[model samples]
Target: MELATKRNHAGEKADLRALVNGQYKGDEHALIERIAADLLAGVSARAGEKPGAGKIVGLSSKAACREIASRLAEWLIRETDRAVDARPSCLPAARWSPEEVLERTGMSKSTLYRGDHAQFYSVVPPGKKNGRAYPAWQFIADVPSHLPHLLEILRSNSRMQVNTFFLSEQESLDDLSPAEVLAGMPFEDRQIVASAQQRMLALPVRARVNKVNALARMEVADLG
Candidate 1:
């Protein structure tokens, strides 16, 4: 019975080895080395176990194969963790530029120059003569959160020419309504008016309304 059981277990172990080797997509040589190490450890452990006569007997091939599989699974997990840890945490800062910021914010050339000169947002100075220009990391750090506001401002400015809108100040404010001011425009102009309205709604109510009113005034002046 013991001999029969050993044969059955050995067959099952061989089947498992074939399946593992065939289905596994990782480095087969590395996996084989790890399995060999595990089998050696298992042999050493089994050697510590004595029979009734006091002679130590190592594990059978089936038990050794099982131990190898277990160890290989553990090693793969550790290797995956190490690979993930080896990757960089943040993108390199050298690739950012003022042109990227302008594209992202959709600001006019005048607005971009004004923002740069006024120091409204920080900028990285071009280092020496041949070095590349890059934006200050902090300026870009919060850009994701600030994008909606910036886009709204851009949309509002774009509508002024079509809606015949004007601004009292460069920045938008409250108490402005493009809908009321641009009521008489044709359907094409109304689309611009509607777009401006949507952008205004996303802004602080006071600033949005004020900007819309300013744009309407500018539009009228342009018509005159």
Candidate 2:
């Protein structure tokens, strides 16, 4: 609803509670009916009409309504993730090319690319093709020891999203970014890993799955 209102798809104001009219009666089918009706109404409004002006007369069947409602939920998750990704803080501080990574870490190309020594944070830079860039912070000090565990929790996130997770200051970590904390000595891996889990949980399930699928597709492209 916030996304719809902000995008001007839902004009003036939008409230989910406002849609409740005592007709639900705790029935699951009725709940779907309400969601499908509002979803259809919103779609029509996007085409050029008042949000509630769309009629449900041609919905066809309950199955169709359920499908529409499911699609609507997925769209909301996607839009929300887009909004999150648009922040400048989502970008890594520095990205190193393969040669730069090899020079800085003094590791063999075979070891570096194999991801055996370090689970290097890999990402494709904007407008680039045929390669991946590694975020610089992942190789900082003892941080590499804790990186694989943290990355496991954030595997579903896009590389930028993972950057955002690590670079942004967290209230849970005494207002230090995970990178800052991990770069220092005596940090508990559990604390940082738990912080990552909390952040990941904030995203919708399908959004996480979408990010995971997107990352997998990018990996396949890189392999090709």
Candidate 3:
């Protein structure tokens, strides 16, 4: 009996022997192998039917095609969602190097990273390079005058939490994120401060205490 054959656009026949022996590689190969198997099954079923018997070959092929289409559609959807979610949305849109930060703020490295109590919020991004990256949102027009005040308000939170705070929308600030509220051309510093204070206050007492305690523990560990 003739085995099923599938040809690529280049008119090259796929290795049905290798595919049947489960020696194929990668998802594309596996999909092609499954399709080949389906076609072979349809052919075998037709060969078994009597010469005058009503054929169900079309129905079998249609069912296999529908299944392959559904699976392919689902795979595509999952891949698209994974690609979207893989994007770095949690971090600020702009991460400036120390050189860029110095260019923007004209602050000396010592002052920029003055031990634990640095002038600016910074993070060490993952990788062997292991250098600091400053979120550009903090330096909207050469570091807003109220930056220190905002940092002080959120001292209990870690740098990551602080970043999250700025990006998060606060209803108290008319549903705008702290970054957005503060970045406004004619924003009231007091209003932004109040919104931040309200957000901190709104946290559960236990959560606030836990975060503060966690920060304290980290500091103590650093000292040791």
Cα lDDT of model 2 by residue, 1-224, tens digit: 87865644322111111112111113334444566766666676676855555344565445456677676546543343443344222223677988988876556788677773236577776697757788766654334444554566556666766666666665644455556555442123334445554455345534444444444445445545
**By TM-score, how accurate is candidate 1?**
0.19
Best by lDDT: 2
Residue-level error in angstroms, candidate 2, position 94: 2.4
TM-score of each model, paired residue for residue: 0.19, 0.38, 0.38
- Give the distance in Å from residue 161's predicted Cα in candidate 2 to where it truly belongs: 2.2
Q: What lDDT score is found at residue 199 in candidate 3?
A: 63
Q: In order, what lDDT does every prediction score?
A: 0.39, 0.51, 0.49
Q: Clashes per prediction?
A: 18, 0, 0
Checking candidate 3 for backbone clashes, the offending pairs are none
RMSD of each: 24.6, 17.6, 22.8
RMSD of candidate 1 to the truth, in angstroms, is 24.6
Task: Write candidate 1's Cα lDDT for 1-224 as tens digits.
Answer: 98996765554333323223232224545555545554555555676732222222365544555556667666545454444344322222333556765664444667556543222233234454442243322232222222223333434333223222221212342332333322211122123434554454456534544555455455545656
**Model 3 per-residue lDDT at 8:** 36
